[model samples]
Target: MSKKTVFKTASLTFLLTLIFSGIAFGQNWQTDFQKSLQTAKAEDKPIILVFSGSDWCAPCMKLENEIWSSDEFKNYSAGHFVLYKADFPRKKKNQPDTEQVKANKELAEKYNQKGFFPLVVVLDENGKVLGETGYKKLSPDEYIKHLETFVN
Candidate 1:
């Protein structure tokens, strides 16, 4: 192949890879609460319900980028809690399957998701309300502290 041809091919491959990887990574964000509860029961962990606007809300984006997506937060979160995310975007845009969107809507109703962005609800394996909080800005250390209170 010519040098220009090789460059174009490599660029296209990289872009496709990125698109697919983003889809996979983003899919992990929406999980069933019942399944999360099952996992929490098996693991003896609490459930951390993250209510977010993955596409548009400012603080929701910030908490993900600044805290939840960080190594520090993920590392701590991985073992302590069965994490579930309920997304109520200004527009339903997560491209979730119909069942998932329906379930999430139920969870949103049960959780009383009042059109707010970045609502955090912590629950036990039995769905007992441990507590609730909202995050506008939190550093990794700050987030860990807040999470620790609920989990421990």
Candidate 2:
């Protein structure tokens, strides 16, 4: 194969691998609050609602990388919690739909009225607030333990 063709093929293969692997390993973050509530109730799990400014907040990005995207948290939370993300992306291209923006605003009013970025709220299956936290420099296991304190 020509060098150009080889490069293209390699790039395509890499992209595909990333996409499929992320699907297999990523944490599932529900976008709809009502749907998450139903799932939480059905699964008998607490709801972990996160409010983040994805494009603008440093702490938010740190938490996402260090905790939410960690293999340890992903494996543990898969069975224990219903995850939801309320993202406010300042970048125009990253903004969610209007309805989603509205819903996120409502959630913020109810749970994060202080407008704290990277806020993590633990709620009962019925959506009552159990506890809230923020970015902490801890290992995934320790973070999981901290979150469990809110639930149990």
Candidate 3:
């Protein structure tokens, strides 16, 4: 192969690697509440804790597909919030470990006592409740604007 061709291939490979890695890392969500809290404090950002039943809840799936997966929401949240998910799946295959289940239950007890699926609770670094929302029929940009009202 020509030297120029080899160089082009190498550059393409590097670019593709970076692009895929960025996509993988951009939607960072933590399962551990304490770890997420520590990260929120360190980053001096608020926490957006999500409670959902991934396998069974239709609204939870809709919220994730329509809002969380959107580029607008991802970009807006990437810098402003520490994301945490406490997923309670009904399927046996999707069940988390005992410790994680217990931790998620504890988090639900504190932040989601009524057991609302797709519950989103925003909290400051000190864990004070700033705002709470659930599945809403809004576009990603509109939803982000709504969240900004609570955060700012």
Candidate 4:
């Protein structure tokens, strides 16, 4: 590659990492408890809610980078479970709207306020709690194995 091209590539890589480093830290998990139940009922699949520290937490960002961004994760999550995000950020200036915030609070309360960053919950079609867990240092292969249960 040419010198200019190399520099540009490096710059782009840095920018990408920096951008993700911020918006990708504590993931603002979407909380659609009703929707999760609806989707689960429709598709006959479970629901997995991923709550993260999307802007300030290292492990949460690492999980997003090393695991969820992959084609493996995307492909696995597709056509299987209903995925919900319920995020709490230490620094998220341009956050979601009021309704979303209220819903997140409700879901957090529903989960008994064990609501910590990086909380992962699984629920049945009827919105019954199946499982809840915190962060784990899962390699891609290990992550794939973990995701298997959520898939049909």
Task: Determine which window of 10 residues in candidate 2 has minimal summed lDDT.
Answer: 19-28
Among residues 3 or more apart in sequence or in different chains, the pairs in candidate 1 whose N, CA or C atoms overlap within 3 Å are none
Judging by lDDT, tell me the better candidate of 1 and 3. Answer: 3
Write model 3 residue lDDT over 87-111, tens digit each, in one string. 9999999999999999999998899
Which candidate ranks first by lDDT, i.e. highest? 2
Candidate 3 overall Cα lDDT vs. reference? Answer: 0.90
Which of candidates 3 and 4 is the stronger one according to lDDT? 3
Q: Write the per-residue lDDT of candidate 4 for residues 1-152, one digit (tens) a residue.
A: 99999999999999999876544443223366786788789888778777777888787788788877755565556555677877666656946677887887788888747657777777788877777666678776687567555443
Give me candidate 3's TM-score against the actual structure. 0.87
lDDT of each prediction vs. the true structure?
Answer: 0.77, 0.94, 0.90, 0.71
Worst 10 residues of 3 by lDDT: 19-28
TM-score of 2: 0.84
* Candidate 3, backbone clash total: 0
lDDT of 2 by residue, 1-152 (tens): 99999999999999999986765576799988999999999999999999999999999999999999988898888878999999999999999999999999999999999999999999998999999999999999999999999999
RMSD of 4: 8.2
Query: Per-residue lDDT for 1-152 in model 1, tens only?
Result: 99999999999999999976654343234377778888888889888888788888888888888987876666667656678887766565565777877987898788854756688888898888888887747688788788778767
Estimate the lDDT of model 4.
0.71
Please give the clash total of every predicted structure, in order.
0, 0, 0, 11
Better of 1 and 4 by TM-score: 1
Query: By TM-score, is 2 or 4 better?
Result: 2
Candidate 2 lDDT: 0.94
